[model samples]
Target chain A: MGKIRTRLGDGSFIELLEEEIYEDLVDGTQDAAQKGRIPPLSEDELRYLLDLYKSKARVVGVDEGHECCLSYDNMTSKIERAHISVSKFQQLQLFERALGADTLELAHIDYSYKQVKHVVIYDKPNMEQAVLLTIPPMLYGAMPNLGLYTYPDGPCPNPGDLLPQGKFDEAKEAYAQAIELAIKDMIFVGSELYEAGADGINFDTTGAAGDAEFYAALKAAETLKAKYPKMGIEMGMAGEFILGMHGEIEYEGVRLAGLYPHDQVKLAQKAGVTIFGPVVNTGTNESLPWNLARSVTFTKACSEASEIPLHANLGMGVGGVPLNIMPPLDALSRASKAHVELCRLDGL
Target chain B: MHAAHSIASGMGGMRTTGDLVARLQLNKGMRIEQAKQYVADKLKVPVTDLADSVTMGEMREDLNIGVVNEAPGVAKGIDAKFRIAELLDLDINCVDMFKDRVKP
Candidate 1:
């Protein structure tokens, strides 16, 4: 009988049971994949496609989001701590006291990074951070496992209470600050650690577009790109504005995810985002669905609108499903390959 | 850079073996012993702990978590359309669909 309270995209909060979240997330994903007429990736397929993806894709990467790094204490000594004001220091203290990054920093990958020639992205706590940063931290003390990132389950922590709608504007401002902090934190990792090893980044995962968070992510990616030209950036979002039969409508298909908003696609282009990934969302929240058709449509629409590479993904960048959790697929069944192929096709 | 096959907390040796096999299958010519050593050294455990000594099939059967094959053994109406209309990119009432059914 575990209970949790979290915020919705519509700026509301709901109390839900752990089993309910699992049923909706884990079970729902399996059921939706079945309904979408997609088969789970077999082990052999996963293996072969992973091979293909590694050899053929422009970029192959792994996400350790700052929490998962095994070598944190050492890395901490290595990282250049940013100068902090007393106020910001207090905020950091609050977060540090509750749900600090200490437990998650694995400290195992030091040699592996040296041995494996690949890209790695750490979090400025990343999206999980964004969720927390969206509201003033003082208002929301980390209640154990509110939403994502808490682990043994997810990255979510109890988001605490929603700030008044009057505070939504303040939340927006906080979003920009969150993006700034992520960039500032990464500057310490520098190109040699992250950029030299990695390609793009999981900029942010905001379910909707045209919000302060999405706009801030775009601005942040643009800011980082100016510093690291070779760095690619990817964002997670959903929508496809369906007006009527006059627009790009299916004759009789049921692709329920939101159509890509025109302005948001423009934002991606402006952000110089290397790719765009979908967060596997099918529950009746303000999120997208786990439908491949929707993925295809999103790629087509975003590519046409933005004229940039659009790579489809199973979940929000990191903490989202399928991306963070496994899809109903065997290890060898290359969900990564599907994304690479989608990027290739979308590029065309 | 894929973490798909990375060993996780509380995973058993059999599950670890499946990831190792998946890694080998993904990268041709990669040696299993080297991978086992890599994992073992990182986790500070012995190579035997990763189940490299066992068969993947045995690992597959013993795995506690779900996999592609472990997916719900049900399908949509067998005769249902396999793919959505490729061009159905119009803006629709996204939220309403969730009320009827959620699928992200």
Candidate 2:
């Protein structure tokens, strides 16, 4: 395994460890943060403790929300629901905070840091909407050309009024600029991350981009993938919401129903996406004993569509926490077993 | 001049000498010389280490934070991804790397 040396609180460098005790420490930290327990460490102290902790721990990439946090509807519509909303600068601040963290050990345990650090970016479906944040001022000047549905608190456009209605020039230019702004934002707040080591910049697109803006986002992804060939942008095609058995389809005059992204996987591959298989959602009625049968059918649909690897998104909804957290223990136990049993699932 | 600054700024913000002196005394109960040495020690350099370009993340990390919880979904994400890595036989070290080079 490759190694990363993290400077500890005492200014001693230790090999950064990934996983093992990291889960418990982070869980405890979240619990503490929630219960008003962990006090703010002075920046130096935070830096030292974070590095010491970073040396040993393994965990997943955390995402509070994608477009859900940055979009206009996210601010107005979901505000009452307690959804998170933050600007690009705020996101840059968050990235700094997270890097300072990097799965540090709180209690006594030995875990080493691995050399490779993962930087995955999710642009909600048509991340083109990102320009709405009023960032980079240049965007403010080039506003009309970007092809966003609407700006924050601005008038919504009727589909008829959306200019050029999917024309390449104006919309594409705006998308390219949006992505550039995103990258620039990342660099502005944290340049050392790129310099620290070769970070794998996985530019994954989601269904949140949807049909209206997906092509624009994908074009940007393709351009980025071409530019930064080393980061190797991977495509994560978000599947359409299908109700599984409750949904219906007819093939060869026979009616059949289940869950799947259907032919959408082909569209992703055709768009130069290396990673196939659209992400399958559980369903509308997210009830207990989550329709395991439907999940199997959904997986089968994705499998039939592509031979590429799959990341089974395990959580459905963790009701009532404002932010989704803590899947039902029973459901999680079953999901764990399913993850192990499904050899085809390369990840979650 | 450099010696005076040594006791200053590193405590973060409040660039004035008097502010630095007051802050050091209030927090660490130390004199200017002691604070200067503390800065040097933190920098792992001599008292006359001077100045250099600091990265963006470094500057933010040096600033104060009320609490340092991991980003929003990071804790749970780690747990989920770790299990996924174990089951998939993928490298747990890199979140972006899966299936040899593909990031899931």
Candidate 3:
């Protein structure tokens, strides 16, 4: 078993017992189910599963001996302690508040781990203070070029339209500048490039046009890689292709194999694409429970077969698990931790 | 930040009694249908009667099922009911009613 060290609220530290951790996992799963939350695996079930990978698993619970304290500086110095049995609904509310709506909606909550009895709170170098900054396309009016993209139907609109557009030359410059800024901010892990459709070279043997889009996206990724050589560059084929679109038959017959082609994975590995994943989830209904499970399973299989570091978008409504029912934040956190551990075990 | 947030934002602007019941946290009642029945039985009235009382335009409009802003007078009644319900592990409807009645 691996050991993890974490800081507590009172500037103290304590180690977490595996038994307590397992209990928390069970409670988290039950709470999530009661609250109608969507998670990859139930907390308890995941805990049991993690035990199978105990040799490779290392978890450190910070502030395990102290009370969970949340500091709110609104007039008075308020501290909210963790509840004994946090519900999934409460977790959803906290996630929405802490992570913000856009980020929460964009990212999927895989699993979380919590201390069963002790509330660990961090004050210095707060890990909970992290924020997700999205870098919009630089082109003045660059639409996401959704002509070949597939999206699910729902209240949430397709974000493809959020891209900027302008003269191709100007757009390239702007994209370059955006990449530079992203690198500076340490947020541009890789480029999420769009392809014309599943028929494009990125996903098929046709080697169609729209090389400009792919080139631009690829160049941005390369530039980032040159600066952060040790960092990863992930090339997202069009959302449609990654999603196995172009009809079910197309998906079953060719698109599926084409999307995760052995050659492309090898090519990306050679090209120094540190991590690559076909963006699987997009649109509103795309984050359904079944979709999430299928995507995780597919991504895991792809990673194992390709021997490459592949990550699913797992953000919000796209390629990530969707939560229809809200659970306690503690449960969600535990569930997320479990999910990440599972992914590691399954090589996702 | 205010109490009305529960009714306004939390409830997604739903005004019907069924909607309110469906959103409330109840132990035994997991689904909307079960919640409706639970509320009807607890209120000592038929499901239709309870629904009608909750759905009546005048009553629904006047009822403030929102989170309370002030505590002294407005939140006390709801707080008492909430504390009791929580202590006894009872249905949340009792607290909801107390809060609704206290809403001006």
Candidate 4:
């Protein structure tokens, strides 16, 4: 029997017998369905991943019409880490002209709306170039980092520090205060960057701080859209399931905490997000087939439910790709292909 | 400095200090030892502190070079690199560009 080439969730290479592939795929899909309370993949979807692994080609890609554009979350910051000496504008240009990114973002190293608010004046020149110079659309991206409001950073007490002390009301109040502060900062910075010539504002890594953070992003996006009807907003999630740090928080009458991607995209749509980037975290202990199957199942549900375009996150440690810093292209490409083919995704 | 850095590098493919050192070596074409010495001098610490996570952690917290346990109000990820560029006096292209373009 021919050994089928595959990878583990860490991006390590391994080979499996042909018979083992079916079992792995089924286990992956079933796990996702049970966890998310969604349907498992049908036989046809399983066949696509099966053929992808069994194919002789080393790497895989989407068919002609199935291709999707990519929207990178932290454009400028990642460039500074990799390149020895590339100007932020030059790095953007490389992404635009050289790399052909469909959408480019201008972000501060801090990667948070509150932090970027302080530096937007310094970023105006870069934002202008991002809009005027680049052929693709440009966005100003940042996290709604509500954590900055906690003690040692801002006036509020840390919820993590308080909850253990039997101070539930205080913790909830802290998150609530942080939400208001974050909403204000996001609006102020989003408006400033939008005025500076950005095509959109991206709330990258939304809901990372918890339901309160998710609530803030939704409120900010709604307010920003009301102000600039033409502006595009993309919300990329930090995880598949929204953590219920502030368990009772709600947006549009839907509870924000403990939401899976399928439900998460609905709130995003109501908030007028132009693109929804849903995340399905990769399981490090699982096989690539297992991870990819689970990722595709969740993403497919998200795409179906989403009225806006779906740009599922396909980066390392999420979207069924491995947890490696540089995720192996074999697994990455196959996962991307499966997402595009099975999930009907608009972008990555 | 020598043994410490190599041991840390072995833990993960590349971390903050390791990444910075490797970048210096590749970009400046310095020998590994020369690159280590250069980073050590720039950060204003003993050479051995480069790989000493505890010392580097404190130093990173102070300098905003990058912190492992990220907290609020601290420089992180790429934000740390901006400080690194200014302190190290290295020619990071984007930082130089931002400096040139900042409005007054």
TM-scores of the candidates in the order shown:
0.33, 0.34, 0.28, 0.76
lDDT of 4 by residue, A5-57 (tens): 88889888888987798889999999989988999999988988898899877
* Model 2 Cα interface RMS deviation (Å): 23.4
- lDDT for each residue of candidate 1 in A81-111, tens digit (9 for 90 to 100): 3333333323332222222221111111231
- Give residue B94's error in model 3 in angstroms: 60
Chain A in model 3: its TM-score?
0.32
lDDT tens per residue, model 2, A57-172: 32211111100000000111122234457544344233223322111110001100010111212222112232221111000000011123334312333332233476434543
Q: Rank all candidate structures by their TM-score, best first, as comma-separated numbers.
A: 4, 2, 1, 3
Q: Which ranges in model 2 have alpha carbons more than 4 Å from their true place?
A: A1-149, A153-198, A203-205, A237-262, A270-277, A284-290, A318-324, B1-104
Q: lDDT per prediction?
A: 0.31, 0.29, 0.29, 0.74
DockQ, all candidates in order: 0.02, 0.02, 0.01, 0.01
What's the distance in Å from true for residue A227, model 3? 7.8
What TM-score quantifies how close candidate 3 is to the native fold? 0.28
DockQ for model 3 equals 0.01
lDDT of 3 at A3: 41
Is 1 or 3 the stronger prediction by TM-score?
Answer: 1
Candidate 4: regions farther than 4 A off: B1-104
Compute the interface RMSD for each candidate structure.
19.2, 23.4, 22.4, 18.1
Put down candidate 2 lDDT per residue, B1-104, tens digits, no spaces.
Answer: 11111111121121111221222221222323454455445434544431222321232234321223334533222243334234333333223332334534
